[model samples]
Every structure is written in C-alpha cells, then in structure tokens.
Target: MQRELIDGVPVLWAETPGPLEATLVFGCGVRDETFRTLGVTHLVEHLAMSTLPRLHFDHNASVDLALTQFTCTGRPEQVADFLERVCSALCALPLERIEREAGVLEAEGSGVADPTTAELLSIRYGTAGVGLASFGGPGPDRIPVEAVQDTVARFFHAQNAALVLTGAPPAGLRLPLPAGERPARATGQPVRQAGPAWQQAQVPGPGLALSCDLNDQAVFLAVQLLRQRLTEAVRHREGLTYDVGGDVVFVAPGRGERTICMEAREGQEQRVTELLWQEALRLATEEAPEAELAEEVEAAREVLLDPRAVEYELMEAAAELVLGDAPMRGRARLDLIEKLTPARLREAFAAALGSALLVVPCDIEVRPRRADGTELPQFSCGQGGELPTVGESSARP
Candidate 1:
C-alpha cells in the first residue's frame, strides 16, 4: 500500500496480484463535486491514452461529481509497464483548464429549424428535462458548445489529478517525480438544483415513466440485481420492452441514484414505462417475498461483497467513504449484509416508495413537425414555453 502525492493531492492506492485470476487492476484519485471535470478527465484519458504503447489491456477513466479516476486492467506480465506509462500520462495530459461562470444550460428556444444531424440531435435532447440544470449528464437538448470546451480545459490542468495502481507492485519500477508540488484542493460536494430536474418528459400518451434513486453501500449490488430482475421481467418474461434499464450513478459522499427507463415496442412505450414504474413502486412498497428477496440478497452479496476482500469491492467502499461518506468498507460491509434481515430491507423499500416524487415532466422529446416539413432547431429551452409553466394551469392540460 503506497499512497503518495503527485501534483499535491493525496491519492489512496494499493497493488496486489490476484493469484487466482492473474488480473492486474488500478484506479485514480478524486477532486470532489467536479462533475464537468469528470467528463473532462475522461476526455483527457481518451486523449492521452495514445501514450501507453506497452499497455495491452482494457483501459478507461471515470469521473463523477465527487472524484476523478483512471484505471487499466492488464495481464500480470504487462502490469509494471502499464503503471509506468500511466504515471507519465497523468502528469503530461494536456489540459487548458477553462474557468467560467456557470450558466443554466437552458436557452430561449428560438423557432429555428435544425439543419444538421448534430443540430437535430441538439434539439431532440433540448426538450428532455436535461440542460445545464445542475443534475448533470448531457441533457436531452442543445447544450452550449462552450460548456463542452470549458470542461475539457479543466480536465487538463495539473492541480486536479490522482492516480492509483493495483495488482503487483513492479519491483524495479521507476516513477518520475516533479519538483514543483501540486497544491491541495478543497473537495466540495455538488448540490442538486433547487427542485428536481430529473423527471420523465411526457411524450405520446400511455408511455413509460420511471425514476429510482438509492444511496447505500449496496448500490452496485442493487443495480446488478435490479437490472437482472428487470431484464428478466421486461425482456424475457413478458417481453414488454425491447429496451429497459436505468443508470446507477456512483457519486461520492454517500450519494448515488439508480434510474430505470423503458420504451415499449411500437406502441408499447407507455405500457413499458408504466410497468417499469411499478417495479420502482414495488421495490419500495412490497416486502421481499421469500424467494425473490433471498435471490436478490444473495446477488447483492456477491456483487457488493465480492470474495476478493480488498479489490474492486474495497475500492468502491473507499470511494463511498471518501467520495460519498457513507456505506460499509473492507470487511465491515460484508458482515452487515449477512446480518441484514429480509424485514429490514422491506421496510427500507417501503419508506423510499412513499417519498415525494422529485421531477415529473411533460412534453418529452416529441418529434413535433412543422408545416414546411421542417424540424425545430435545438435551442436549450428554459422552464416555461409558449404555453404557461407546469403548475400555472390545471386548466391547460
């Protein structure tokens, strides 16, 4: 276990050989609540990836609102070479950090027709409840091009980076040390906007609408289990949807949400969303039936509490604490789950089910066409439209 400071920020690290699996894994460090940095860091990762000539494995980087991480998975023989290259890559990544005043990624939707596919895409997304509205992820609408440039620049700067290498520590590894130290950065959490912006946008009637968010140590486990069940039910059992699932955003400081979405086959979009919604409602409202609960709990245990004590599972726990601040770690979480009663999980589910809905959007990305066979330009729209805002009229709908 060698945790050090490169460019000044403290990075948590370790290396070990999966004597059983022969896998070599690595990770990166965090600068809290830098969501744009996450995308930027990933962009830099893609840009600098050209440097690793010796690497012959899967390489990727992930940045969230809480931390930025770069990782590589390789065979035992190439582990040492990969680490050295990574060390150099982090220091040399070309970033022209752009600091700008944050803008509401929304715009006054000009009644212009989108000309190109890119422009059409911009418009398609603009109407979705996505915009620079604080709950991150490229909204389903036109994003200011400058926001993309600004994030890319911030990712290249020196002061905000940390790298971790796992698997075996190379015996004769040579690491470059810089003379000018990196200064410490304060880690601030990203705040969600005043109200919930992450809601379902309405399209044609009877389409699916679903939302789910969970903050727990067993989140990944929950995701895996949830996906499995949903896939089996939606795709396999009833075959109601061709596509169905959500994102498990693993952010820091005990914060991460699970989102589930599904559009029906042909006219089933509404049907699928309703079914998907039931599952979210089900997870919260129903007690875990013996067989299902046992199966899910077991699945959760495997994913969240992998047998490998200090590998991916350990890293996630550390990420939860360092980034999110809650969830069990190391051996502690495993033990906790073993003692978890089915009743406990059921109650937890019920509480979440009854909670108030955060966002519920109408006018999802419908392909509203014009008389001249022209499509609308993708301008990021604000909260209101030519019609009144959401609450102003029960009369309008």
Candidate 2:
C-alpha cells in the first residue's frame, strides 16, 4: 500500500485487479449522533447524493455504525468526478432539499445493524452512542435542518476523512471538503450491563454478546471457533437452526463487542437458545484442539490472502485512518494468527465470557448458567420491572 495527501486529506492507494474504485470515508456515523439527532448522519448522506446527476456508472454512498462512505467504481475520470461532486455536495448541501430527502429516507427505511446485534448493543451501552442502534428515534422527518448543518460542519470535513483506491489516485482527483480538526473520540465507552446476564428481546433468535478487545487475535479466533461449533451442533446435528453467524461492533480503541446471533427454525427458539448457552460455556471452559484452530486459521488465510480482497482491505485501512486506529495489513495479521495457540485462544474467550449478555426471543423464558453452574442474572431495564418516575421525561419532536 502507498500513502499520500490530497488537499490535506490522507489518501491510501494500492494496485488491484478491477476498474478504478475509490471511496471517501469519514470518521462519523450513527455512533456520533444523539437520540434527538438520530439518523442525522444518514440524512446528511442522502442529501449529498441527492445533488448528483443521474449517471450510468455505478456509484453510491452508505452510513454504518462508525463510518460513512461515498464509493464509486468506473474509469479514472468518472471516479474523480464522483468524488469531487460528493465533496462539493457535502460542503454546499441544498437545505431546500431536506424535506424531500427526509421523505425519501423514510421510504428507504433506516437500519444500522441487525435486530439481535442492535439489541445486544442497547443492552451494553444503554441509549447513547453505539447503543442507539436498537432505537428508531424520531423519524427522518424529525431531523432538524440545523442538526444537518451542524453534523456536516463537525464531521464531514477534510481532516476527519480518508480516501482509498484500488488503483493509483486518479489524475487531478481532488477532495475539496471543508477543513476542520478531527473531533475527540472515546477510548472507553460507558457500560450499562457489565454482565453475565440474559434478557428477552424482539430478536429472531437467541444472541450472545461479549465485550472484548477488537484487536485481540485470540478472541477473534475464539469467535470463529464458536460460530463453527454452533453451526455444527445447532444446524447440522440438531437441525434446529438455519443460520449461525457472529459480528464484531467497534466501540473505541481496543474495545468492542463480539456477538453471536443464530436464527432458529420455527418452534425451536428455546432449544436453540439453550444450545447456544451450552456451547458458549463449553468453549469458555474447555480448550479447543490444535486441529480445529489450524482449520480456522487456514480458512482465514485463504480469505485474507485472496487477490479479490484487495479493495475490501483498502476500505478497511481507510476506515482505520478515519477512526484513529493503527491499520494492520493482511500479511501482518496472518503472521499474528499463525502464532495463536489453543490455550491462549481459550483463555481469552473465557475471560471475555465473564462479561456476556444473552438475549433471547421475547416469548421464550430461560435460566442460562455460567460454566461453574451459577445462574446468569435476568436483565431488567428498571428497578422491579417498572420505569423510574424520579427522572424527568423529555418529549420527542
């Protein structure tokens, strides 16, 4: 990979097999907004794209949990034109278009994460920062014009942005975004449930979330191994689950949530939930075999070392730059993965499970347990299952 600067914005580029692809990434997304200004970042994204003329080439934009990306894949000139127009639109977004774009966004429907992961986040962080994923705060129509302007001024700027490309930077490519200092980000987010607890939520199936270091290779492998074990037990052996997967949500530097979500067949929600807990406890208590660890490590290497992953890797690097993280290259990461022993992976996973939050479907009742046979606490949003009347209630717009 090569690094350079364009109009004071950091640019990372590398050679890959594809039409020229470029992404302008900013270090802001749903996590940067509050309940009152929910969806403001996405509203900003829509307003910017609404200004572009319809073109035949592929171009689009998206806002995720912690980053917003404007991406295009076309000839060099086309890519350059797309980036320029996006930056220009962001700088001078037509306030007049806010109402129309709000309606458009309403039709589009906003969802930052899947239901299970969102519920886990809400359980972990309450109703602020990354926790807002589970909330649908006042609709897009409620996002104020002033909020949009302020969001753009604070986050959509050159210093908070990074550009990455599959090919060399296009000739004459310019990022003419407004200049501003990168805003301070939290190194450790406040926690609501530092828990080994279970709760009922509106999720498709049971999910487990463990707070851990995002960069920990052992925890990474543990998650992969857990997913594999669940798939083997819940899907193939029991035939109760249709899909089993996991996701990692970034909270701050070296801090994040590792979530395992499973979608079970109808009428098997409780069974799947029980099985999930059993497997999680087993993985936490028992050491994995060397063969299983090697299998997972090889699978990871195949995906990371594949040539087609170049663009994905570059986009990740750009996100790291925008989020104030030190980027790890594929080769370097593979080297770390190769050295992980089964004992180390098991130890890391066991430590992480100490802070596990389990969420099951609302209709299911469960009493999950830790490896030592102690029952996990049942989660409640308020004291004695009732809302607190002591705090002031603020009305929404």
Candidate 3:
C-alpha cells in the first residue's frame, strides 16, 4: 500500500481493477459513546451524508464498533466531490436537521452486533464501551445536540482520521475536517464477569464468547474449528440449526472478544445449546484430528491469496491506525497457522475457555459443565445482597 499526506490526513491507497474507491475513516464509533449517548456516532454519519446533493454514484457512510467511514465509487472527480462535501459537512453539521434525522434513525433501529453477541459483551464489560452495543439507550429523537457536537469535536477531525483508496489519490483531493488532537486510546476495560459462566437473554440461539489475544493464531483456528463442528453436529447431523457464524471484536490493542452465534430451529433450542457446549468442551479437551486441522489451514490460505485481499488489507491498515493497534503487516498469519499443532490448538483453546461467557434463550434451562466436571456458573445482572430498610439504612456509628 502507498501512504501519503493529504491536507494533514494520512492517505493509504493501492491499485485495483475497478471503479475508483475512496473511503474516509474516523477513529470514533459506538464504543466511544455512553449509554445515554448511544447511537450518536451513527446519527453523525447520517447527518454528514445528508448534505450531499443527489448524484448518480455509489456512495454511502457507516459507523461500526471502532470506526466511521464515508465511501464513494465513481470517476476520480466524483469521488473527490463526495469526500469534499462529507468533510465540509462535518466541520459545520446542520444541527437543525438533528430532530428530523433522529426520526430517520428511529425508523431505522439497527445495531452493529447481533443480540447474542451484544449481550455477551455487556456481560463482559458492563454497560459501557463495547458493552453499550446491547442497549438502544435514549431514543434517537431524544439525543441532545450537545452530544453530536461533542462527538464530532473529539473524533471527526483531520488528526483522528485516515483515508484509503482503491487506486492512487485523485488529483486535487482534499480533506477539510477541522483541526484537533486525537483522543486517548481506550485500554484496560472494566470487567463485569470475566469467567466461564452462562446467562439467558432474548436471543435467537445459543452463543459463546471467549477473551483472548487478538493475534493468537491457535485461538483463531480453534474458533474456525468450533464453528465447523457446530455446523456438522447442529446443522448437518441433527438438522437443529440453520446458520453458524461468529465475529472477532477488537477490544484493545492485542486483545479482543471472539463470539460464536448459532441460529437454531425453533423448539430445538435446548438440543442446540447442549451441542454448542458439548462441542466447545470437546475441543478444549481432545486434540483436533489432523484432517480437520489441515482443512482449516487450507481455508486460511485461500483467503490470504484472494484478489480482494489488497483492498481488505488497506482497510485493515487504516483501522489499525485509528484504533491504536500496532501494524500487523509484518506478521504473516497464514504462516503461523501452518506451524500450529493439534496439541497447541487444544492448549490455546482450553486457556481461552477459562474466560468464556455463554448466552442462551431466556426460555432455555441449562447447567453446562467444563471438561474437568465443574459446572459453569450462571450470570446475574444484579448483585446478590439484601437491601437496607426503606428510608432507614443501617450505619456504623
């Protein structure tokens, strides 16, 4: 990837055989908001895109867990115009449109993570940072203008943003966002339940979350192996599930939450939940077969060599810069995956299971156990303690 500075913002680009693609990425996202201010980043994205005039081009904006992006695909001039307008809008957001746009946001009530994944994050980090995903908080219509202003001031600026393109930077392209210092990186998240526990929520199926080093090749392969097992056991064999997938959520530099979510056939939630736990314990204990491990490695190889990897890698580089993670470009994940042994995979997975949180539907009843015969504890939102007498609390005198 080629790197340069455009109007004080770092620009990363590469050549690809397609329409020119340009993306403006900022460091702020849902993780930067409080419960009362949830969805504010998304609202800001909508507000910026609203300023653009109707044009026949592929352009849009989005906000995720750790970054906000405005992208466009077209001729170089069209792409340049779209980005210029977006940056101008950020410098002077039309606050009058907040109420109208809030209604639009309310009509489009969506979240970045699935319900199960969101609930697991809340269990892991309380109702802040990544945990805020589980909540809708105040209605968008109630989001104060002050919150939007503060978000832009803190995050939407030249110093806190990066741009990437599918080709070289267009001639005369500019990023006119206001000048501001980048905010401090978030680290050492507060934990609510750092454990091997289970909880019930309004989720479609069973899910599991494990905390581990984001760069751990063994854990990455273990997740892939577990997903494959769930697909075989719950979907192919029992016909109790339809979808098996997961996401690796970036929490801090070198740390993350790996989540696996399965969609079960109705009335078979219990069986699916049991199989999910069973497979997890089985992987944690037994060594994976050589054939199974080889299959995963081959899959990893395919992804690294695909044609679209260049664009993906550029986007990843911008995200790393925004999120304060060290550039992982030097480390070859595929090479590391090839060197992993079944015993190493089992050990890494077993270590991660020590910090696992499981989520099942509210109607499902379960008492899951670890491989060592100890049962995983159930999670509770409230502390278990007696309350003081109403208006007459006991005090030490």
Query: Which number leads on TM-score?
Result: 3
lDDT tens digits by residue: candidate 2, 1-397: 8899999899998898879888899999889898999999999999899999997799989998899999889999999999999999999998899899889988988689878999899887878888999998999999999999999999999999999988899899888998998888655465656888888989999999999887787888889989999999999999998789778788887688889999989989999999999988888888888999999999989988999878777777888888876656788888999999988988999999988999999998788877778888888866556776898788896
Off by over 4 Å in 1: 1-39, 51-69, 73-78, 89-166, 177-198, 202-229, 242-244, 304-310, 317-327, 354-397
Clashing pairs in 3: none
Q: In angstroms, what RMSD does candidate 1 have relative to the true structure?
A: 11.5
Q: Identify the candidate with maximal lDDT.
A: 3
CA deviation > 4 Å runs, candidate 3: 384-397
Instruction: Give Cα-based local distance difference scores for all models.
Output: 0.41, 0.88, 0.89
Ranked by lDDT, top first: 3, 2, 1
Candidates sorted by TM-score, best first: 3, 2, 1
RMSD of each: 11.5, 3.5, 2.7
Backbone-clash count (model 1): 28
Query: What TM-score number comes out for model 2?
Result: 0.95
* Tens digit per residue, CA lDDT, model 3, 285-323: 999999999999898888887878888889889988788
